[model samples]
Target: MGVCFSTIKVSGSNSNNNVNHNRKEATKQQTKTTKATAPTRKKQEVVDHQQNNKNVNNEEEKKLKVKEKQGSKAIPCGKRTDFGYDKDFGMRYTIGKLLGHGQFGYTYVATDKANGDRVAVKRIEKNKMILPIAVEDVKREVKILRELTGHENVVQFYNALEDDSYVYIVMELCEGGELLDRILSKKDSRYTEKDAAVVVRQMLKVAAQCHLHGLVHRDMKPENFLFKSTKEDTPLKATDFGLSDFIKPGRKFQDIVGSAYYVAPEVLKRKSGPESDVWSIGVITYILLCGRRPFWDKTEDGIFKEVLKNKPDFRRKPWPTISTSARDFVNKLLVKDPRARLTAAQALSHPWVREGGSASEIPIDISVLSNMRQFVKYSRLKQFALRALASTINEEELADLKDQFDAIDVDKNGAISLEEMRQVVFSLSNL
Candidate 1:
């Protein structure tokens, strides 16, 4: 029952403008104001000149001023700028139709002129934008992203360039809308715990990889976890490494960052590590299980207090049928003791996710239901599936079964999740 990215083919909409704006606002940092200067002999040019003549003054020479090298065209996994901004629009993407807009950039369906395949283009401006952090963040995102290409849960990127006024990132685009959007739409209500288990497994796998690479995704939320195929058959991808960091081993950052609802206590306190991402994953997983966020606050102050307290309302969640073992798994993840919580690998081994105690393959078939009617039918089947699943499953197996369903249900209609399955199990128990 895992949600499949391929199942949801959202037509590009004007509403995407909001998404772009959001990315922009989140990533765009304030830049220092400086007098605009004309293009001078680039420091690369001067460096080249010095290489040919060692008799020059070593004390007063500048950097990057050497003669232009053709190899300077584009560095592999290195940032490059091949596009420019529209005079009025700020940054312009020439190859594709605009698909979405973020606060500081526009995402486009672009064609890779070199390969002839269409790709998504995210545009940004470096010097002019009010947000100063956008430049550095985007740079780090590209660097980290390029290193994570083959992972199943991470999004793939290609050319990342910085132009005169803007920066451009061309990469694989997931056409399915955000999981947050699907959850909010109230169109899906039948997804099962079997679904969520699959997603969790994939996420853990990717998170472990990131942790191994010394990278930590400071921001982890539904919006950041993207669906690759949008069906029960495929898997969900971990997207947006913009706020990520590759700290040297045992190092930490003090930046107060991440989405308010999903931000971990350590993040707000400006002390963080890979565990910060794990906490975020817990919040996202909790949201998947229940219809609402685990820690909900009407005000920013309240939200902060809730996080600081490290208290979660398990008693309030409507999972009367939830198996104790499955609940135990979530409890372990949501634990305040970072040391006590299960590592990604340990979580994947939980029984709720296993099918008959065997490691089952990911369900990728649901990717075919891309249309509205298909989704409607899919939702109906999902509900029916949930009711039947509750009575038949082993309690210990719920953990693994949950994400499997969520990954395939890509629509995120709350029809598939660990909590949803728990509800079904509760019903069975009552009867």
Candidate 2:
């Protein structure tokens, strides 16, 4: 995720609109170097900027103004203005605050003066689109979004307009923030199985729609899932088609792109298809059910190592409480073999999804409560290994937690510190 620019009022005189737009374009590009990347996967997709834009001061503006800037056409405002604010996008959209930015451009929550509707405008500065591949990626993103218009679970692409300095993309505003933020913000840090089912169903619906339209969203993660509105049951719409591409039937993509936590095993192996997105949904399902990541590790390498070799932790505290159908659903999609994994349509038809997991009012299990109490006491590394071990444990060995400890001590670093034990004991007493 990119930095979210704080909302600033742009209700000033329209005299400096072109200068302000250019300043924003330059600020967004300068901030590109700040994008976070995996240590091992240095070449990940150039993500867009975060929400909200800060107004640049005059001195900074002078220093940062685009050197070879050309267009400064003023947009005609008022009710009769053409769509997307006539030809000059700056005139129509008074960029209020920077919403977010990416390698290609910045996203702003712009006000459409003519309609009074809030629209998210992604500004892809032509000056920064230096390489052919980068330019093509932007084109592909626009093309995919255009083709997938009117999808219920995908972001609505209203218009894509370009001037000499920037390509402006107007899209439906998702006011509810990322699905990841929603999950993590919960007090218990978890969604009910029924809620998970609803979320996963929406995600799968988008995935199915994309596949049906001959496209593949190479990157599918919680951050990409945004709520359509602030309503309680507002649909989660998938956004960010930067890493997406058109795929013909039977074609396999070899690009290893995607956020580490939700990437599929086949992607790590350099072969991926629509099933890869299914695998990501499985990861999201696990997180939705439990607050924790299934194959988490401190480092990207450690995470990838687990993704390549480890099964998701189904025997862990939360899993023990999770319904059997829910477990089966996740297990089907997280299969190590892509061929064995469930497709989006198939996963959508799973019993748990069909029934909407456990009912919303259902209570979580005591075992899950107890395990979560003890689980949080462990060091990050130990917790990581324990979760990984939990997935591999069979039902027959459920009673003896100790029996699985040695198996999880993969590096033979077996000593549990007295301080750690004391912390666990103290946590248990409080529980």
Candidate 3:
């Protein structure tokens, strides 16, 4: 049985606002959570900057100012903005309603004046490019999209334009909502193994293409994928290249990035590669087949631990009904050792997810969607509760806590190291 999703109805209760708020909170939490496990080079740089601020003389400051001015003038397209594109955004397109907004800028629906076709325009404000790396990330995203947009599954990039204030990236508009929204809007919140195979196959194809081009899509959660239209068989397009980076042969990315549920074990270990993208696909596939996250917990730390230590549970209700080939496909992708895990190309050839494979047409149990919905709701509530708890505490109440933290922070670097925390835990455990 093929799964069909209905258009999501928005009530007057501002449910959309709530959902957006939760998503933002989730993003913030994921960033905070990953810091506990990832390398602290960025943190160390901040500490170094703070320390350097005390010793800098006026002569050094003036020299630094001169260098900054020289660097600014050396850049292209005037000032600090250089998008390598024409700045005729006013002539080419008419911007319409705001689709969404993020830290950098807002996304809007726009019309191509030439053909009267609608497109999505991501307008990134130049002022928000506070860090050099932030500017480079935007440039790289455009470069990658320009290179990879030829693929069927990737979102089509129309043009990149820049002005003194903002950079505009116009691309194909996906009228259909996110993949997660489609799953939640399903009539019975269920998909047959065959239906799942179709979705997974597209995702694997995208992964294969990205890997072929030596790009690692560090973030590949459901929210990053969208249907080109609202049709039942609309082609899914992979979007969002903010966290993506190019990888040379035998090179691995050290930065930990990605959503909590979809992040791979190697990512937490700070040595991720293209295989990590496959791991994320495995996570998505597990959720698709079982309607629940393979690695999950009430806390992000716990979720990371689960991803590192626990194997996905396949003895549950939907898994029992799922085919052996399907189970094997997921197993190979979710392997803890990236070396042992299936490559994107290898996974595309798996018997379960491959075209015309043994995936069953029987619909999975309806409870699968129910579980997924509950999981999302529970996560939001948990985040709300944590926020409430945090808001209740003030700096005065944390004075004693700060003292204890400072004592344990042997380097006096304003942050405790993982080794220091582990030693403390070990001593306490023995007591």
Candidate 4:
């Protein structure tokens, strides 16, 4: 939802022009989680993940009572004027700025007339819903938002109303804007490992809440996360459920809907569950610390291929500044096997996450960075020979190198393929 992102230069590249060009192209043709909906995708039969979970509407009901006490009812503003704004929707909100558009609709910032409170109104045009699938997608989004209404890490859903032309979804406005913007705006231009831990912890909490409520946020990109205000530590709330679904725990989801960079390996394989969201969080964590993507290419299809196969390069520059515990956490989440990936709750409890801001004080590994610089320039034959040589070295003394070698051998075939070596070679040639 609200798909937009700046380009991130890949390893060994001296220019970000290719990244910027690809980002522009990707913005024009954003993937909307329908890849899994293809006819050839196979459906798997598994027990529902929600059978053991109860709906959390008690919080929603309490919030509703509070809103009612404030007399915040949607009032008709009479005739449509001002470029489609109902003079007054439910007689309460006066639409303001056009925030952004998602896969199924547009979102606007609106003013609450009664007390001047700001809110976001997502408008889904009825005429655009020519397919039954599109209509159901809208309904499912509304349902998931209503179910997770009062969760602190979720954007609160105030009301959902339908008119002849559009379906309006009103909720709290995130004035600080997208989490991506906030991350980009950081004074230092990048988050420290500790700072990234805080962000990832918040993301996991939201994911944990959503999963517990039997919902899977099919699209968990940074664009879907928003800061409530301008405060540095403002709570991050997950938004835009357009591609989300009520996925039960054990049941698999075949719909391949999500941004290319953050989509999980299983989602590409046409079988996914809540763990898919965790994989996305891992990608976010990787970007948060390094100001680059772990898996990136010049095209969306290339990016998808990398996500489905390539292992994250934890031996890259900025990564040496990150803590061992932090790398360990990311490794666990980015696991190719969804079942082996850390659950949201488990990620929240990770040593890196639990350590929080304290992890920033850990000393950087200067030697590792020097080693990476040399490693990046290695030839395909040399890379393979080095890996073979690494196996003969004392594992404890050269543990980091051993791990780096293994990461490049992503397929775990015990030998690095020319295709794998080309990933680094191509980046170097681009320089």
Candidate 4 stretches with Cα past 4 Å from truth are 1-90, 188-190, 355-358, 361-431
Query: How many residue pairs clash per model?
Result: 101, 21, 0, 11
Worst 10 residues of 3 by lDDT: 1-10
lDDT string for model 4 (69-99, tens) is 5342221121121123233476777888898
Worst 10 residues of 1 by lDDT: 30-39
What ordering of candidates by lDDT runs from best to worst? 3, 4, 2, 1
The segments of candidate 2 whose C-alpha lies over 4 angstroms from its true place after superposition are: 1-86, 184-191, 355-360, 365-431
- Local lDDT at 191 for model 1: 51
TM-score of 3: 0.72
Question: Superposing all C-alpha atoms, what RMSD in Å does each candidate have to the true structure?
Answer: 30.6, 28.8, 28.8, 31.8
TM-score of each: 0.58, 0.64, 0.72, 0.63
| Best candidate, lDDT | 3
Residue-level lDDT for 186 in candidate 4: 58
Sorted on TM-score, best first, the list reads: 3, 2, 4, 1
lDDT of 3 by residue, 1-431 (tens): 01111111334355576667666777787789787746677778888997788567766889999999756534532236566779899999999999876546789999999999999999987765644666888989999999898898999998999888888999999988887677778775456888878988999999999999999999998878998998998999999898898999998876668888999999888789999999999998888887789998878889999999999999978788888998999999999999999999999889888899999998788877778778768666876786677567653444346558767877654345578899889989999
Q: What is the lDDT of residue 209 in candidate 3?
A: 96
